[model samples]
Target: MYRYNDFDEAFVRERVAQFSGQVARRIDGSLTEEEFRPLRLMNGLYLQLHAYMLRVAIPYGTLSSRQMDQLAHIAETYDRGYGHFTTRQNIQYNWPKLPDVPAILSDLADVQMHAIQTSGNTIRNVTADHFAGASADEVADPRPIAELIRQWSTDHPEFQFLPRKFKIAVSGAEADRAVVRAHDIGLVLRERAGTLGAEIIVGGGLGRTPMVGKTLKDFVPLQDLLPYLEATVSVWNLLGRRDNKYKARIKITVHEHGIEEIRARVEERFAQVKPAFGGIDMEMLSEIEAHFAPPAFVTKPVDAYTRAHEADPVFRAWADTNLAAHKAEGYAIVTVSLKKPGQTPGDASADQMRALAQIARDFAHDELRISHEQNVILPHVHKSDLPAIHAALKAADLATANIGLVSDIIACPGMDYCALATARSIPVAQGIATRFNELKLEHEIGPLKIKISGCINACGHHHVGHIGILGLDRAGVENYQITLGGDGTETTVIGERTGPGFAYDEIVPAIERLIAAYLELRTGPEETFLQTYRRLGMDPFKTALYPEKDAKAGKEKAHAA
Candidate 1:
């Protein structure tokens, strides 16, 4: 995890002081809502449907046990008893009093955390794969680079007010767990010519216009990353559409002008600015890398773990699903599923948060990670500690034993909280998860990702799910549009929209039909929903989803006969 230095500490304290004054003014009626809107947004405070929500950034989704404890304390003291982890790997308190926001920010700063850039149209939190440094297939840890980017982008004069919110994700591993292709900018660390480099993907985003980012630079050398990134964002800042908020994302800009044009402009800017970023930036990167050195590990035998797995079915199931491949032989990356049945997806209670902190301290070298799918991870838990950790997590309701299962959904707070939402999303997600669990078919249906968004903003990343559901308003009622064959993995691709949208009541049933169609059409059990869908196409699922229309069409043909 990245530790805050004196500069970071001083900056946060100054900001807290500034915000404290702002809060006082607002409470005293000197600053109206309109006057204080931008100030509040910069501090990650939002006036939601019922109350003010405070979003705190977990930079690159890394946290220490102490930091986790601090978050738990905030959840218990400031707002409700729980905090909702988001797709961007940040946490949101859905109910914080307007006046208490500065206090909450102060509490966060105490643990070297803050809500800065968690909202607003600036560069939001730089996210990375949960299993970053520990993943078996990683070429390099991306967090150090992500942290460097965070430093560069934070309060950057040129980018503080962009056309719209910008997101950046980095993945060190080959598996692409961070959903890099769905972000505004994606960095995949790779090795070329015996040197570490990055594969830069630009303008990939999910919103009103979803796009799988184009490869801007196939391999950007480590020394040139910041300069190239600055150039890319600067180009977008200058040329990106600002006339309409809906079309302000870089995705729209890339779509309108094409990737070739965007790439050429970025390259031109990079060439012009490369000279300014010399040895000074390189030295700074080395300093940042030193801060991210791996913690010491104790070698331990895990033969007992193998025996325990053989003896316990529940442990075996959890081991199979919840644990990920780690670079270390005796260590594992454990994903704590936030999607427990009947609970809100991505939410962790204060007690649960504290329990996770304890687990990290006791078994995970005090290291924690937050996945892009809204789950917390103990990135370096020893295999021998799995059973005990699982037991503790179960008690805290943090152990759902469903890491990649269908019930593990990513959903944004829709009409329930977000003012920009056109329809409800969370309830629909909960309904789908419940229905699937009731059927006991989630396991049978392997590796299915269902993402729901309140609106076209794609905050929930609906466009990249194996099954994407986007909520909208149709005739004063909630409706959903479905997309198929979308993937947020190494082989990134944008999903194609299926025909018509379904009403709110019909959405879950439509998803069920689609899954059933996949089950029927799959070649074998090993074939996942996405593989089957890609193989068979949407025609079959389309017929099942709108069976009545298909049947009526058949009857019309018969009448013609």
Candidate 2:
């Protein structure tokens, strides 16, 4: 939770005033839709299929309870009753009126938040591990570096308009919760010989062309990160394609020119820019680090927590699924699930947001985090507070014990909201979650990630799900394609597609068949779907998906042989 200084306060207020005038001009016909597109996009406003959507950045996914309350207020007053949390750890208000955007932004500014750089073909929100300071296995908190990058990149003269939007993710933990491999620039903090630095991974992205980022620099000292990043983005900004918007991303640039050449160019540019950074970045990072110091953890008995776990099966189930080990002795990290059965994957109602805020204030350390998995996190909840927190969440309908389960899916706002989508995604996700819940096999099925995207944009990150579902329009009918064995972790891999697409009506049953096949093929109940898929490969799942075709092909191959 980095608090805004005097300069930050003035800067954001100035930008709000600037955008307010821009908005007025658009409404007054001084600026047409064509003219206002870039300006509005720069402010994180989008004209969606039905209404305008505003994406507000949650830097490093950290928020104070006060800030959370402000967001809830914005949702209740300006937009609809709920807000959608995105895969980037940002939040979207889908029903804001054109005239009310400035007011909404003003409210955000009051809370030291803004929508700048959340959209546009510039460096979007700099994301980090949601459990940055609270996780037990972290080398160090990555938020200070993330904040430094944010301050440096916001309104940088050289990078205001790149060839395409760029993303950067940082993770400090041994486990890759941030999915850094799928970003344009992924930084994994590492310590060698008692000194901290980062391992840089470049060119990773997912869309029509999915790639796991290749290692660019094995280790870069913390002090030199900014200069090195400047080198990387400057090289791509100039070399990336401008002719076709589709191929304008830095990922495409890295694909065309190998990593070696890119490294050479970046090194050449690094020498030129390294002098300008002359320790100011380090000074600022030091200042930013102070704002992120860990909360004073209180020592408390866990007798109540143990009793609740032993006595109440419901509380125990929720705790087992939703809780993670914290760095502090008595504290635990709690993930508040937004993917309740049949609801949108990442949406939180205004009341739910308020409830979470109150719970954070009372039971937690007044801190909240938005995980990239589309869930809210109370990162410093004492174990003794678990029973009360669980009761409050249950009252708000936020007590779903499905974290990392089959029903806890990640899906994008497809044809329902996005204009670029070719088919519907929300309904498909709802159908899948509801179907699995009805079957009561989610816990039995074990940990699984099912990501869905309405199109090739891969906003839902389907390319990295254990079971990836991509919805497309096949001859005006909705069709879904499946990819298996995709993972977004330290050992990241793009999913492999199973043969053909299934009709919308057939997609859920097709998923069921795949799961059934996995259960049968696994060595035992402990072997998860992903493990079975990796051990046995896609042939079995494909055969399950297209039984008649697989059998016919097998007979044809036998006859030919």
Candidate 3:
């Protein structure tokens, strides 16, 4: 965890002061809703369907126990005693009063946190693999460079406003846990010529026109990274479309102007700006790396964990699903599932938040991570602490043995909260999870991702789920559309949409039918939904969803491919 320096502290405090005045002016009738919209968005405040929502940035999803405690405090003291962790690895307060926002921000600033750049047409929070520092397979922790980009982009006058919101994700592992391919800018850290460099990926995004990022540069030396990024954003800033908001993202720009031409322009810009970055970022990177040094580990006997797994079926199930390999010996990374059945996905109550904070402080290092999947991660929990941690989480109703399973669905706060939403997403997600839970077919179904979005904004990343569900309003009725074989990992691909949409009542049954069809059509229990879909293509899934349209255009395309 990087502590804030004087400059950092002064920066947050100044922003808080600035926003406080903005809020005051808006309240006192000096500014109208129209006038304050951009100002509020800049401060991470959104007037949602029901109430104002405040999104706070958790840089690279890392948080100290003390900072977690403060978040817990905010949830309890203000709002509704709960907070929603988002796919961006940020947290949103659904009901913060207008007057109290500044105070809440001040509290966040006290812990060296803020909501700056979490919204609006600016570089939002730079995200990375939640398992970055702790993953055994990582080439290096990506936080140092993620922090470097954060520092560089924060209020960088040149990029204060872009045609659309820009996102950057970095992953240090061969496995793309950060959904790097779906970001506006993706960086994969790898060794080139005996030195750590990055593979820069550009113009990948999901919204209306989803695209897997294209490689901009195969290998950018660590020192040249800042300059390369400078060129990338500069090129996009100048050439990206401003005529239509829908065609504003760099992904569309890259598509319209071929990637080769864009690459050429970026190279030209790189030649000019590369001279200005005289290793200042490299020095800063070194300082940032020191703060992320690994925590000291004591080799603990795994006898207790082995015994628990051998004796307790429930404990074994949770451990198998929720645990990942840690870099240190005798330790495992624990993913605290927020997708408990019948609960809102990615939401943790204040008590649950405090429980996790306490568990992190006592059992693991005083560190926690917010994963892009909207789960809390205890990144360095010793194996010996398994039973106790599980017990505590179980008591809190957080011990759901479904990390990548059906019940662990990803969904957005749709019409239930988001004003931009045409249909309700949470209800649809709840319906699917509850249906599967009642059927008791989740674990048997194997690893599956069901992502739902209220609209085509793709806030829930429906385009990348193994089973993607998009909610839409059709002629005053709620309709749900489905897509198959979408994935967000290294083998990234946009899902194929099944022909036709189902009514709200028909959506849940539609999903059930799809899953049932998969079970019968799959090679065996060993074949996962995505694996089966990929191996056989969309023919079977489409037949399952739309038998009448089986030999239609979708089938033709599937058959042709």
lDDT score, candidate 2, position 429: 92
Taking the tens digit of each residue's C-alpha lDDT, what string does model 1 give over 1-561?
677899999999999999999999999999999999999999889888888889999999999999999999999998888899999899999999887888888888999999999889999999998888888898899998999899999999999899999999999988898888888999999999998999999888878777888888899999999999999999999999989998899988998999999999999999998898875667878989998887786788898788879998988988899998778878888999999866788989899999999999999989898888999999988898998898899888787878888989999999999988989888998999899989999888989999999998888888888998999998888989998888999888778889889998899999999999888999998999899888888899899899999999999999999
Clashing pairs in 3: none
Could you tell me every candidate's TM-score relative to the true structure? 0.98, 0.98, 0.97
Best by TM-score, which number?
A: 2
Tens-place lDDT digits, model 3, residues 161-223:
998999999999999999999999999999977999999999899988899999999999899
- Which residue pairs clash within candidate 1? none
Task: Record all residue pairs in model 2 with backbone atoms less than 3 Å apart, i.e. clashing.
Answer: none
Residue by residue across 1-561, what tens digits does model 2's lDDT show?
799999999999999999999999999999999999999999999999999999999999999999999999999999888999999999999999999999999999999999999999999999999989999999999999999999999999999999999999999988999999999999999999998999999999999889999899999999899999999999999999999998998888898999999999999999999999999999999999999888888997999999999999999999999999998998899999999999999999999999999999998889999988899999999999999999999999999999999989999999999988988899999999999999999998999999999999999999999999999998999999999999998989999999789998999999999898887899988999889988888888888999989789899999999
TM-score, predicted candidate 1 vs. hidden true structure: 0.98
lDDT of each: 0.90, 0.94, 0.93
lDDT of 3 at 260: 99
